[model samples]
Target chain A: MALGTDYAQQDCSLARALEVVGERWSMLIVRDAFYGVRRFNDFLAHLDIPRAVLTGRLRSLVAAGVLDKEPYQQSPVRYGYGLTSAGRELWLPIYALARWGERHASDGGARTVFSHATCGTRLDIVGSCPTCCVLVAPEDVMMRPGPGALTELRQDPVSRALGRPHRLLAPIEPLSETVGEQAAEPVG
Target chain B: MALGTDYAQQDCSLARALEVVGERWSMLIVRDAFYGVRRFNDFLAHLDIPRAVLTGRLRSLVAAGVLDKEPYQQSPVRYGYGLTSAGRELWLPIYALARWGERHASDGGARTVFSHATCGTRLDIVGSCPTCCVLVAPEDVMMRPGPGALTELRQDPVSRALGRPHRLLAPIEPLSETVGEQAAEPVG
Candidate 1:
């Protein structure tokens, strides 16, 4: 089933936002970016998305100013994707939606837990720090695998690396240079 | 252009949430439900969405427990759709995404402004009541056309009725009972 990318008739701002981030795998890609999964291989490994779909989504995100591509290596012209300020502003919506899923959709507890890096207070359902009484920014939050997280999830290196607590927006270490090279070309 | 509906390999809660509401027109339908457009024709008129798409999305939502369909007219067995508790919990994410679009995507100001119904203080970007320093629930939020709202938008009855200030989750007056009957069937 073909879904149109643009909501031509709707004048709502939500419609506009959807135009940018509302594709099938787009939001999940953004979630991975927040988790500091920058390189193409990491996203591919963690998401298991088709290479062509990942390439198209990354291109669209970069064009929409949600993610910026910059060269990380000089010789082969390998680039890493990072979220722009506009993209970082999406944290609230992403967090809120994930919280909703944890409460209403997930049978077990949250698969991931977020806490205020400074106070270590777990964020509430609305992404607010109860102890600080403030909405925690993505930069100020840390994520850790929760009780509901599957113990033996994926065998991918990126999935393994994500098991430990990490601050949001900090880069996840790439598994290897060869993995990036292998992921450079989009496969059918 | 066939986008698969499920992210089977992704183990994230956000993926789970998207599995439920991440379709092309699903979030917009949820947005209309928040605006209290209960009847099928009202949604069809206001959204300008294909009747088939609306029907499919609504059915999906009901199946996901985001909406419930109940009898509104008995003679012909007509039904009206309303958001369930699980659906109402989506307000935070919806508001956050709309706010992000208004700030980064819109050229003019907001098309809609949400305020704390009690204190009449405009909600902050994160949907928090600045005056009370509390998060406002959808029930207690008031919505009105903002400065950037186009003077003359759609000519549909639902669009015209939405021009004035209305409380979220309060039903919008149906244009006509007959409109419901006309839209009862889903078109291919």
Candidate 2:
């Protein structure tokens, strides 16, 4: 569907915003950033995306100011990507859409569970902690695979690292240097 | 940019959700439905979308059960599209995304202002009525043009109808049968 990239002359903010992040794989890239996948290779590995496509999405995101790239490894000049404050603001929509997906598109269970990091309470559908009685920001949320998570499909280190609870926005520390990209075995 | 229509193996609820609504004009079409757009011509006029493209999107949405199609005119058997229960659930993501767009995509001011119909208070970025201390549902919300609205871009009846404060999800009644699809003049 060669629907043009921009919703030109729409006179709508959602249309304008869609021009920025509505491209395919763009929102998923943002979701990976929230899940702590930072390096270009990690995103490529976990998302099964074409390397050039990943490169373009990252470049577009950085240009849109939704992401900021900085040098993490100086030897080869490797850059790591992280959400800017503006990008972080996307958490609400991400959560809402994910929750909607879980409700309508799921095979039956949560793939990952999110909780308030402060008190360890699961967030409600609208993203408020029932126990804390407050909205849980992505930075303060902890994530782990849930019962409905398909544990057998992927074996990437980034996917393995997400198998356990981790803080949102924190860089995912791979299990070990010895564990190759496909070293991890499927637990299912 | 031939990103395939589906995320083949990504294991996330968000990924599953994106497969359904992440297409180029899919979300915008859904947004239009929420804004009380029904009938084929109205969507075509209001959206500036190709007729064939509109037909495919509406079909896809209906197949996914995000929208329901029914006959509103018996003589010609013309169909009207509206959000299903599952479709109405998309309000959260739409609101969240639109709010994000209002924050980041705007040139300067709001193009449309959303408010809680009960108290008449503008909704917060998260779609909550601060006055009522509750999340405002689409059925109970009202929408009207705002300071930044570019009134001159299009003069279709749907656009003209949206100019006034109106309730979300109610079928938009065209001003008159005499108003041809392009009968109205630009507000600017």
Q: lDDT (CA) for every model shown? A: 0.84, 0.86
- Candidate 1 ranges with C-alpha deviation above 4 Å: A1-4, A174-188, B1-4, B175-188
User: What is the DockQ for all candidates, taken in turn?
Assistant: 0.63, 0.76
**What pairs collide in candidate 2?**
none
Candidate 2: regions farther than 4 A off: A1-4, A174-188, B1-4, B176-188
Give per-residue lDDT, candidate 1, residue A67.
97
TM-score of chain A of 1: 0.89
lDDT tens digits, residues B1-188, model 2? 33536786888888888888998789999999999998889889988888998999899999999999998789778889999999999998988898888888778688999999999999987788999998888999999999989977788888888877889998885553544465556355
Error in Å for residue A105 of model 2: 0.8
Residues forming the 10-long window of minimal summed lDDT in candidate 1 chain A: A179-188
Compose the digit string of candidate 2's lDDT tens values, residues A22-103: 9988999999999988898899999989899899999999999999999877877988999999999999999999989888
Question: Tens digits of per-residue lDDT for model 1 on B68-151?
Answer: 999877889989999999999999999999998888777689988999999999999778899998889899999999987874
